[model samples]
Target: MGERIASWFAAGHRPLPWRAPDFPAWGVLVSEFMLQQTPVARVIPRLEEWLARWPTPADLAAVPPGEAVRAWDRLGYPRRALNLHAASVAITERHGGIVPSDVDELLALPGVGPYTARAVAAFAYGSRVPVVDVNVRRVLARAVRGVGEPGPARTNEEHALTEALLPADPARARLTNAGTMELGQTVCTARAPRCDSCPIADACAWRAAGYPAYTGPAAPRQKPYAGSDREVRGRILRELRANELPVPRDRIAQLWTDADQLERALRGLVADGLVEIGDGGFRLPMH
Candidate 1:
């Protein structure tokens, strides 16, 4: 499976900037953050601009966290900006401006979870660790377990499966990891899998089994964006990001009529350190 996937990836994988051999580890880390819950097309331009603006972890660390939030723009989840800023600061202060190669050290950084840690280790450092994400999980579910979809969340079993599939050679294992993810993302998609084009289609268990429908628990649905606290929070942040000075309370109130929702959103932003309340007005956090 790894061999076939690697071959397919070599021929067809998208030429993303971070996939380049000489791309900095910092760039890989940033790409991972931006890719979360965001499409590749949406992330690409923003990622390119972001790397050009702050080329190194230390360069981003030198600026206030607010600048990171402002630069984050309309990425949906603004807290990721804060997480990236904090991670950059950690990398600068503790790792001497270098992204850590060790998975444990990477895990210790803010917002660096198991998947991200393993990804950085394998992709950036050529570690022989399994780099499992949702895409990989889905591919494994269908191709190996003969299921239509993966489990609702990643499991220890999934990790073990991915680990077992990794090639013994570290560099080869890195290629396999990335190849598997790329295959899942581009071909073995959830809605419309291009099974005929898949490199491992002939050997796919799910295809042989007649593509069984998933009977497992459904993944949780995302809440609607309109009229939600999230919407109000985004609006508030947009106003703040657009202004150099603090936005007055009344001005913020005008963005949304539901006072309770707006207040809750403001409080949540403040608690999340994405906003600062000062002098009877609100603004993006200064630090």
Candidate 2:
């Protein structure tokens, strides 16, 4: 399984900046952070700009949190900006300004979860660990388990399957990790899987099982972005990001008619520490 996927990865896979030969660990860490719930195309340009501006953990840590929020722009989840900034500060202070390659140490950093920690270890440090993203889970489900979708992550079960497939050689294992994720994103897609293009299609369990419909317990679908608190939050963040000066209460209210929702968004941002409530009204965190 690892060999086939590794070969498929080497034959294709887009030339992302983080995938470059000897790309810095810091760059890999940032790429993983920015890639969370965000598309690769949108993340690429922003990732480049971010790395160029603050090439290291110390460089990013030196800037105010507000600057991080401002640079985050319309990334949807602005809290990630605050979390990334906090993580940089942690990396700088605790690890002497280096992104830790050890999974446990990586997980210690703010905003670093199990997946992100494992990713940094594998991709940055060449650790022989399973890097299972949503894509990998889907691929595993259909190709090996004969299921259309992986359904709400059963971490231990999924991790065991991926770990079982890992190559003994760390380098080969790393290649498999990248390959499986690529296959999931490009070939074994959630909506329209391209079975013909998949290298493992011939042996795919789901195909052999006649492509049964997914009827088991599934992950809940995401709520629509429009008119939700998320949309309101984005609007508020957009208003704040556009202005060098702090936006006043009434000025922001003008952007959205739902006064209650507007207040809720502002309060949410402040509570999340992404926004600061001050005499100047609401603004991205300055301290």
Q: Using Cα atoms with residue i matched to residue i, what is each candidate's TM-score against the true structure?
A: 0.97, 0.98
Off by over 4 Å in 1: none
Clash totals, every prediction: 0, 0
Candidate 1 lDDT over residue span 55-106, tens digit each: 9999999998889999999988999999999999999999999999999999
lDDT (tens digit, per residue) of candidate 2 on 204-264: 9999999999998988789999999999999888888888778888898797898998888
User: lDDT per prediction?
Assistant: 0.90, 0.90
Candidate 1: how many backbone clashes?
0
lDDT value for model 2: 0.90
Give every collision pair in model 2: none
What is candidate 1's TM-score against the reference? 0.97
